[model samples]
Target: MTVLVFLDPAFADGRIVDAGKPALMATDQGATRGDGIFESMLAVDGKPRKIHRHLDRLASSAQSLELTIPEPEVWQRAIATALAAFADDGGGGAAGGGGGGAAGGAEAVVKLVVTRGVEGSSAPTAWVQVSLPPEAGRLQRENGIDVLLLDRGYDSTVAERAPWLLLGAKTLSYAVNMAALRHAHSNGADDVIFTSSDGRVLEGPTSSVLLAHAEGEGGTRVRRLITPALDSGILPGTSQSALFGAAKAAGWELGYGPLVPEDLFDADAVWLISSIRLLAPVNHIDGREIGTSDVRAALTAELNELIAAT
Candidate 1:
């Protein structure tokens, strides 16, 4: 089941709409031209986690597109309305939305989207969507995943050179990202990690790339975490940011990168982190296994605990 709440001024708490029915305008630029911004977040026990961070990123994305979105209060009200409606409407009953069922925690995907609205309109069309997360994501978290490296056809320096590319925004223009994932599936891989044309590891199509390194063991052990630089034309991942904070407090070192594919291969462990999927460990990159079974298991367990603590 899905719950949708439109951000309408006429309704102080926003307006709930039938998700099974048509709601968006056919002429909306967000649909026709992909002129929109969106953010996905996780909700547990009926409360959205890292909400302010998601909202902050949403604001950043809207500003990049020159879009005017409602204030944070409006979004918060709408999300609240959607969650309440979801519970009352029997949408996710006991197992999907708020801390029950098989995915371990009561979890849901809360997505905020704002389109450029109808062609002649000056106002944006904004809404909040809440629904169950896909099971494949949970499976990947437990079992890990195999990945293929794909070229994104851009150099590492493109972000500063081309602002119009909207490299740092979480926009609705996802055709290429989807296509890359499909290409990976067709090639018999579970996912993809994109590299820059100049050979820098960028990110995954729908997630951020993360790698971990552990030196020594037991009493002398030191753990380190690394991800690509923010200037590498990738959307800043909320999950990565939260996990880094949690990891740092747990005494793990943190680093940024203009990382190369070799960095991924040499790391003690690798993962693709995102909002909905959380963290997924990478078992293989281009058919060569990464890390050892024991190391991967230990690191995955440690990081997952950190993420949960966040």
Candidate 2:
């Protein structure tokens, strides 16, 4: 079951609506023009993870779209109401929040959405959705996935030259992203890692690209995690940022890059990280195996532990 909570000014805790009924107007720009912003987060045992970070990104997206939304505190209250309702309705029963992945804990996916509302209405339609994450995400996290590297049709400099592209903002416009995933699926791949037209490794359709390198042996070993630079027109990954912090505290080095596919191939291991899927190891990319199975399993376990702490 899904829980819906509309952020109405008339209600201090948000207005709960029936999910089975029609709540959105047909003319809402979010539905018609994909003009809006959204953030999806993981809630474990009724507590949201990285909520502040998600809210901050939501605010940034709103600024980019020039669309006003309810304040962070308002969103927080609505999230609470939604999660409570979802649990009470039995949506949060025995299944853990790991989305059925290796993380395994009581979990729910919480989505915050705001649209331009009906044409000319001026008031944005905003709401929170609480529900179970797809089992496919969990399965991908467990068994790993095969990916295709596809050109995104834009150079890394596109974000700087075209601010209107909203490259840095997580908006409702995702037709291209979804199409890329479908293309990967049609080609016998489980997912996609988009590359810039200029050959820089960007990110996945709904995740962030991360590569790791290990040097030395035994006591002298050094492990480092790296991700593409934010200036490369990719959405900032909250999960990656949180993992980097946890990893660093555990003595793992960190770095950012203008990486290419070769970097992925050269790394000891690579993964596509996100809020819902968590950290899914990429077993192969474009038919080439990533790191050896032993190495990948080791690194994945180490990182999963760090993620659990986060």
Candidate 3:
């Protein structure tokens, strides 16, 4: 199987050749040990959606870690060029031609990973890699996904203790994140949601949670879309942002605040959003059946419209 990867420096050859060895520094080999940042992005219609936002987040993460990155234009060009090649090779296709059968009809996932450049014996290596297209993100969106709540928390205290905790940064060190997802799969769930040891809902292992308002308060009826607050220590979700905007444009009220497990059940709708999954309507949580609520149809319609417009 040929693996499609974006070389940091552009290359013409599609196949991986010994001459195209990655310029990996010693620091990237195993010098520094801590959280490394990373970002997962998606390509729609053969183009990345909100590319600047993802890049902005990447730059911020690097800055927080005191690491430098290629200029925005350089990075953008590298990614764009690679995607164009892939799209030509059946990844997506020339833009505006429907790009059919290319990773779910011109929709693909592009992941960006950057590490701190080697700094002395104590510095970690800096590197970046972009995946061709993520099939998993596509699968989850097509078919509803099941999620299990892990009692383990991301250690909120670490965010302050190690300012470079990489939680906010899109670091490269993601062994724990991968392990959490595996843990969920091993337990019969398609994905995992992290929660505080004390039962405070955090986020999914790879997506953000959006809860629907079940009841209106103070004579103001809450509409369809809702999510946890940014201060709640959740990874800001790109798809959720788009969904919120769509809901608002369609006259739906979107709320953001802290929510509990009970809130998930009480919510008119519950979804896990991310670059890949887009929006996955959760059918069940734990062993209980959700989506039986009154707002199920409205919420489903709202999600369908959002996808159609996109």
Clashes of 2: 4
Error of 2 at 22 (Å): 0.4
- Model 3: what TM-score? 0.79
Clashes of 1: 1
Ranked candidates (lDDT, high to low): 2, 1, 3
Candidate 2, clashing residue pairs? 96-105, 97-105, 97-106, 97-107
Model 3 clash tally?
A: 13
Q: How well does candidate 3 score on lDDT at residue 143? A: 58
The reply for model 3, stretches above 4 Å from the true place, is: 1-35, 94-104, 118-132, 154-162, 214-222, 293-298, 307-310
Where does the lowest 10-residue lDDT sum fall in candidate 1? 95-104
Please give, for residues 1-310, the per-residue lDDT of candidate 1 as tens digits: 8999999999999999999999999999999999999999988767888999999999999999999999999999999999888767664455545444222457888999999999999999999999988878888887889999999999999999999999999999999999999999999899999999999999999999999999998889999999999899999999999999999999999999989999999999999999888889999999999998789988988888888888
Q: 159-226 in candidate 2: lDDT tens per residue? A: 98999999999999999999999999999999999999999999999999999988888889999999
Which one wins by lDDT: 1 or 2? 2
Q: What value of lDDT does candidate 3 attain over all alpha carbons?
A: 0.63
C-alpha TM-scores of all predictions:
0.97, 0.98, 0.79
Model 1 C-alpha lDDT versus the unseen true structure: 0.91
The candidate scoring highest on lDDT is: 2
Please identify model 2 stretches exceeding 4 Å from their true place: 96-100
Please give, for residues 72-132, the per-residue lDDT of candidate 3 as tens digits: 7766666666566655556564343233321245666666655554555444333333344
